[model samples]
Target: MTQENHQKKIITNEDLFDHISGFKLEVKKTVDDFKSEMKESTNDLSNSILRLESSVEDLRKSTLEGFDMVFKTIDDTNSELREELKNDNIILRKEMNQRFSVVDKRFTIIDDRLTVVDDRLSSIEDNMTYKHQLSPKFA
Candidate 1:
């Protein structure tokens, strides 16, 4: 009976140690799985950020091109307007000079007629003085 009791009591600390070791291995596997899932999530977020950045850059370039085209159109319009104004000014000056020349010619003709009238009046005054000197004396 004593020998049989010794054989049944053979369960010892080594068996407990084996059970604890198996439980630790399962916990380590769970931690490794969680780490792999976090790495995948981070990679997805990085890809989305890169795509957003590229889209923003494209928008900026398109906006700059539109503004450049508008500025060039305004400059062209301004240049055309300036040229038209210059042509109008030149035509106005030419017309004014022609009118002034016509007026000057008319004034010169009037001045010549006035000079002839002055010479005729001077001869009439000389004939009246000669008649007064030849009259007979009064009694």
Candidate 2:
């Protein structure tokens, strides 16, 4: 009976060693799976960062282009307004000159009428002097 008990103890020790080996394999497989998952997460994070950089660059370009277009439009509007003002000024000057010419013509007509009235007054004065001289001879 002692020998049979010793043989059973030996078999139990061998089974324990087999169990420990299986556990070690399972732990190694779990560690390898964890490393793969970590690598996949790192790759995903790197890709996300790249995409963010691209989006930021695109927004910057778009903002610059929008500002350029706005400035260009303002410049074009200013030029057009300047041209319109210049044209209006020219037209006003022409109208003012024409009005001044008409006033000068009216003044010339008034001067001619005044000269005729002065000549008639002188002739009436001479006639009155001649009539007075003839009446004095009767006295």
Give candidate 2 misplaced runs (Cα > 4 Å): 1-24, 111-139
Q: Residue 2 deviation, candidate 2, in Å?
A: 17
lDDT of 1 by residue, 1-139 (tens): 8899997888778887887888888888888888888888889889988988998998999889989989999999989988998998898889888888888777887777777777777777676666666764521
Per-residue alpha-carbon lDDT of model 2 for 1-139, expressed as tens digits?
Answer: 9998887777676698899899999999999999999999999999999999999999999999999999999999999999999999999899889888888888888888887887778778777777777789634
Off by over 4 Å in 1: 1-37, 109-139
Error of 2 at 5 (Å): 14
lDDT of 2: 0.88
What's the TM-score of every candidate structure? 0.55, 0.63
